[model samples]
Target: MDKYKQYFLKNIRKKLEEWETVPSISHNEVYRFLHSIAGTASIIGFDEIGSKARKLMNQLNETDDKQWTIEEVKQYLFEIIEWFDENKKDAPVSFTDKGNKYGDKPVILLIDDDTSFLMYMKEQLEKVGWYVAAIANPQKAITSFYDVRPDCVVIDIHMKETDGFAVLEFLKEKLKQQFIPTIMVSVDSSKAVRIKSYEMGADDFIQKPFDLDEFIVRVKRQLERKKHIDEMLLLDELTHVYNRKYLKQAYALLQSDWQRSQEPFCLAVLDLDHFKQVNDRYGHLVGDVVLREFARFLKQGTRVSDIIVRFGGEEFVILFPKTRREEASEVVNRLREQFECHSFREGGTAFSRTFSCGVVEITDANEPLEHWLRLADNALYEAKENGRNRVVSATPSQEAVHQKIIKIAVVDDDPIMRTIITDIVTKLPCERKTKHELQTFKDGVEFIASNWHREHSPCLVILDGVMPKMDGLEVLQWIRQQKRSDRYKVIMLTSRRSENDIARALELGADDYITKPFKLLELEARICQMMKRMS
Candidate 1:
């Protein structure tokens, strides 16, 4: 038997013997001891022993009096001992070993009221290459959790100020963003405590007088599991590049640098050309290898400070910090040349591959991250349009020109309203080189019948909600039913300010609802917001 099982058998017998003769031993004391046993037994997979002890613990806890009779305590203890004796022959010797699988040095937060025990465990863990922080107070441990930033936590369930269960609850609230392995330890071998601890998200449970070797092994195992889980959350499994989650974190940091230092950076969107054909011709397994190798190439080609992320399948994004537009373009083009000349293989069958890239420099401090991403995406779309296997760069000016060439359509039965909306759009501040045009329609029916969307689709459509025949809502619905309805932003102009009409217009995919006689500046501001989103 492992040291944990041996220790539990020895201690439970002593506790039961004491309970039989000691009437002063309160039900709380007996229950606490039994609860610890139940938890430890369960952790070591001695299910029968754990269940019996748990049943007895619950019975004691449910008693009307806080004290248990000597006979009652004896009966409970006997049942648990009988279960343990019966299962002792079949019980597994030890828990599975999961240490040394990962190279990281784990930082462990050790919280126990017993100062001597906490210090001893800390010393032993540190001796075995763990970074250990020992705390004798539960409250102190709870408050210092973020500062310590330990990979895992170990807390005694029977602390003075507060129990480990309370610490778990408090720690959970504080560390809501990420998972941290927590183990509960105590001398009281009771099933109720084990159940409560597990319910509160305790990762593991151990009884007192744990074997030092096994204790260190269990701690290392938890750390290993945590490392595995964290990698799964933050890494792309196939390519091993930082996943989108990590990308967001990195972007936040980089954005802070940009705001503080006005740092120059560029975003590049890369797509493997004809990647689908790779899967179709050579099989998905080979396609996976190609993706992995391509990711390796990207990692090798980029600077250490550059952030490479597997944005999605066959697509990757690289954030080039402190790099200018022309420099970024040159760097990516060199990678493109190398990738084009490289040969990928599957089962000794070699095939050539190429990639297309689009890069956009971060120029506007006020522009949102999505705007920069969209700019790079638009450049990528252009690269694909102009043929693949090349690198294309987009400056802020070029992006603004491409995104802000607003073609607007104004539709209303009243020619006056149509002209009023058209004139408003024409008066907006725009670049002199911009191809801003206003198309006028007498009614929704006339607007829907025209091939306006086919040639130079309008960025925004000003549609009167209540028009004669094929009303604004109907036209909006028809426009939404077309392919890529999201490409067109429609503002519903309604004279009626009823809640139901506005809600219906919004439900039918009107981007904005403007009641009649709206402020000119408010309308203009909303249009500017839409332009920002478009950019």
Candidate 2:
């Protein structure tokens, strides 16, 4: 039998004998003792003993008759003893040696001033093949931890020279490795003590006279969880691909190699076609699944050397090392075909997926990173315009086409409403006429404060009413007071239908009032009319 199981059985027998003599013992006390035994036995793989102890504990809890005689208590204890004796012969193989499988077990530094109790725990833990360094002195524990570089530390809350809480504070300050998990073990079972231990940066806690099974379970669980968390930091939760953060780190190393070898590389940008429409029609949950499955397809289709990354929502970027434009185009073409054929099903409804791609080959030494990225982005734009679900390459002739500039300003407190207006403006012909420079402000106060100067002005201002910092009418009044520019025009965009709000905006020299969710064409025509008037 495992030594921990034997220890647990001994404790169970002791609790049973106590209950036999004092039949009036609180049910909670008896339950706690049996629960501890059951938890420990299960941890060490003493299934039979653990199962019987759990059943007896349940029976004790369910007995509502308060008038139980002493004879009844003795009979129950005898039955439990007999049950353990019968199952002891059939118990499964204990996990006494499994700790060694971890390969160079991490030393656990256990600090407790109770010398006898600390020794008992250390012996029990070490019997299961765990490397334990026990110390009755807090100062000695710190030295041992530094010498051994223990993976974890357990400190008792009460000690002679210093308390466990103090020792924990010392470790947190002195141990430069904050990632090391620390646990506090104490007989102080009060909620306040547990909360205080947590505040002191203890990862976990256990009451004194801890069940050996629970101790091992908690230790193993914490170590495994830490390992898994470290791995997940490198992965993107949405697409399950390596995130751009990881890509940037890996690209730095690859860039050095390219600089030394004078090798060529290609960077491709991929964007889902009409992805917003998918979110609008199917909701974000389905859209998320589509993105995940699409990412998986990209992973399966790409070469092992290629680095794929989720740039942001509905957009992905891939780095093809030592690949030329033609090779990258072939890879993109395959991916495009695969996506066109892919159908995602949500709630028994199927939807087809398509994506547009742009590729740029890094060949010129003078080309800046932003310049190449812009080239690819422009190519992607062309692909989207010329019926998406295709690939476009950056050509020198196409790169010569100048992007028109339009200076637009939006004043809205609600971020979502501002985004909606910005989206509409980006799709307008004015965007193509003026290479789009758009600015958004949360409130009218921010707009007036930032754009008070004559040189700092936008061609058109989309203003909102009923704002907290400053109302649209107040902003228009301020603007009229300054007489800043004749070129500037204001459009009042609001959700309010109040005639008073509309009349005030126009009375304060506002050009127009557009209600929420206004038609895109109407908004464009209104702006063009104002522009013509100014001209």
Candidate 3:
């Protein structure tokens, strides 16, 4: 037996001797001595020492009313101690064989002041092929702890200068690390002490006179918990894709190389078509399942290098590093097809989901990073307008034909309304020839500022009524004031059915007014009629 183990056994013997002579044994002193032996035995994996200590303590409690003679108490203590000695030797040999089978595991730091207990623990732990750095002083633990980042730490509550709680606080603050499980072993069985140890971030605690099996089990549990936490941090809780946080971190690393090499890259923004309807009709649970399955389809369809992030609800974004626009289109098409074919089942009801995507390639040094993102968003808007469940890509040369084509600007703050108009225009016969090209803007200011010049003016302007920045009536007034109102066909699309608003639009040179939720065919017919008049 190592010195600490021998010392622990000697102290137990001393306690038994003292109890034999004393008229009444102090329960506190008995607890402290037994706890020291149990803790030492547990550290060395000597299960019997800790177990017998617990049994003896329980026996003492049971016989508290009876006045026990010294001989009776001595006999009981000796039986417990002898049982532990025999088990200690046998258990270590068995544990040693098991340890060899697993090979040498990582080192663990054992901090306590009791030299006899520490030596005993070191011997038992070393026998099992676990390298241990046993320290008596809590003050010296900090330097030693940093020198070796042990897989786990076993700390005792009672030390010379500082207690276990102080040592734990020091470790937490000084190391600047959390989640390192510290098991605090002490004889103070007070509830307050245990609570304080936990508040200081101790993973587990052993009362003085601990059970060996319980101590080992607590240590293993803490280690397992830490491993589980590490895995959860990498995963997205909603769609289970690599989360946006992880994507941003990965993007920063990959972007530099791609930029330096002038390698092509593509970004795609994907949105579920009329997803709110799914939640309203089938409920959010079904919608959630559809999202998860759709995300899975995206993952399976893309290359390993491709990163997918759930960019909030009903929307997802993908980064395809070192991939061109055409390559990205193929991936997006595959994902779309897969999502379309797959069915989501919830509560015995099955439904199909479709999504629209916009893809843009990383190009141009002059444009900001947000521009590429906006381009994809614009293409996604185009896809929604061209009809849902479709893919759209921005062609660079489309801007060059802004003048030659009959430029039609559709401005609406309402996404659905904008989508409806874009769909109607893209499906029109004139759109096939690219002669009636379409441009969309969120508000009047953006449209006016970009296309106000006569050379790049729109042939038709569809404006929404209520908007921020500037309202449609203000935009119409500005257009009429320019004396170029006669040159363009203006249509006011409004949710308001007020006769005064209609008359005001007409007086402001608007050719027509289309109401909300108008029939798709009727809107198409109106555009055709307006185009014919312009011709």
| Global lDDT scores for all candidate models | 0.70, 0.67, 0.65
Q: Encode model 2's per-residue lDDT on 100-163: one tens digit a residue.
A: 2212454566777665565466557655555555566676565434334556788888887888
Clashing pairs in 2: 186-208, 404-434, 404-435, 405-434, 405-435, 406-434, 406-435
Every model's TM-score: 0.36, 0.38, 0.33
Predicted model with the maximum lDDT: 1
Q: What is the clash count for each candidate, in the order shown?
A: 12, 7, 6
TM-score between candidate 3 and the true structure: 0.33
Q: Name the candidate, 1 or 3, with the larger lDDT value.
A: 1
* 291-368: candidate 3 lDDT, tens digit per residue: 778888888888887889887667888988888899899889888887788776767877788999989887653455
- Once fitted onto the true fold, the runs of candidate 1 whose alpha carbons sit more than 4 angstroms away are 1-300, 305-330, 337-385, 392-406, 427-436, 455-458, 497-499
- Residue 280 of model 2: what lDDT? 61
Which model scores highest in TM-score? 2
User: Of models 1 and 2, which has the larger lDDT?
Assistant: 1
* Prediction 2 TM-score vs. true: 0.38
